[model samples]
Target: MRIESPPPSGIPGIGLRPIERSDRQAWFDYLRLPEVHEHTSWNVHQPEDLDPLFEIHESVSPTSPRRLAIVDLESGRLAGTIGFHTVSDLNRAAEIAYDLAPPYWGRRLATQLCRRVTDWSFETYGFVRVQATVLVGNERSARVLQNSGFAHEGLLRAFRMVRGRPGDFNVYSRLATDPAL
Candidate 1:
């Protein structure tokens, strides 16, 4: 099923959309930037590496992994991507992941996108909990999650492998019962 755009981000001219094949080139351009990849655990190295991620699917399954492109609605530029890395119906939970192009950094765009997506996830999926993880030293990303109302939980030792070696992560969560942002 096609998930409608969550809601207005209130960030004039910036919005979310389902990733399309046409976005592959722009997505590749941003994803390949060294600075963009340094903090996140994106494994993409070449354009072809992202083909699988952009493959068209007829409808979204409840547990299917999803990634939505963040676009500049007015300019039609692919600014970033964000969505759930994992979703679980039985657990009533999901994990959110997102990244922004360097040009868009320091603009509060990530925080706004994160807040809107988290609200949509809870409303659409009836999830009790939404969580995010950031590499230990990624202060910017951690701040994004916190500004989006996610409370820092704790650090997970070697929770994820970035590039190659195991990297420690800080986990954060926002629950349905939490005060609305």
Candidate 2:
């Protein structure tokens, strides 16, 4: 599965498009936000810290992570990013993750983003499962996954290192046979 070019995410009010070079600054800025970084595993202390992401997005392939920029339909500004990582062809599964700018929080855009990408991943790649790991305390993200039709699988105790210390994460998954709400 050599991902040459992905199509637009026909999600209403927002479009999920491939990440571009111009999006680097906006992504960097978003990652710098304390509210945004608090939930993610990456600790981006400087602008240069985002350079690797830019590099990966620049040379994306099917074997590489599929990163898409979630853009607002009205403003055309990047609301956030959502993507599938740790894709396993043998397992027909992948790990999904997303983050939005603080301004876009509580807009329900994250749910839509997750649905579009999850549907796309299953439809496009024949993936049987898509999983998301949300930090235990982040109820908002948990709700986003639930609203998107993902079921809470279980908890991975001290699964990820957030900021610096280890933290528990609630595992969530949506199977291809699951209902799309």
Candidate 3:
């Protein structure tokens, strides 16, 4: 399923929309940066690697793995992306993920992005649980989740591979019943 409109970010000069083909260059410029991918598990090594991500799938279900660009309204630049990594309608659950370019970091943009997407997932998809996994030691990301009302659930031992080696991750989650931040 393709998401046409992203929920309002509540941040001035920032907007969200489905990631498009036009964004591939800008997305790759930052996503492949060592500073940006160091804390996440993105495997992007070249621009072509992101092609699959931009394909618009036609489906009625809103649970498909898709990303929305966090854009700069004035310059029309790709500031970052936030979206669902996985969704399980049967379980009323989904995993959320996000990343911001180096230039856009440290502006509280991540917190707003996460909050808006989490709320949208609950309301739009009828999901009861929205979760996120931060590679261990990615304190900045963990803080974003915490500020967005995701409580740390626990640590998963060797949960994923980061930059080739197995890495642990800290799981966090926000439920529909949780008070909004």
> Which candidate ranks first by TM-score, i.e. highest?
3
Across 1-181, the per-residue lDDT of candidate 2 in tens digits comes to 2244555666667777777768777888988877876767878877677777767655535556678888888998988888888888789899999989888898788887788779888999889999999988888999999999999999999898887799999999999999766
Question: In candidate 3, where is summed lDDT lowest over 10 consecutive residues?
Answer: 54-63
Could you tell me the lDDT of residue 97 within candidate 1?
89
Q: Which parts of model 1 are misplaced by more than 4 Å?
A: 56-59
Ranking of models by TM-score: 3, 1, 2
Candidate 3, residue 15: lDDT = 91
Candidate 1, which ten residues in sequence have the lowest lDDT sum?
52-61
Q: lDDT (CA) for every model shown?
A: 0.84, 0.82, 0.87
Clashes of 3: 0
**Candidate 1 per-residue lDDT over residues 28-112, each given as its tens digit:** 8887788877887878877888877655322477776667878888888999888885778789898998888888999999999
Candidate 2 Cα misplacement greater than 4 A, ranges: 1-12, 59-61
Question: Which of candidates 1 and 2 reaches a greater TM-score?
Answer: 1
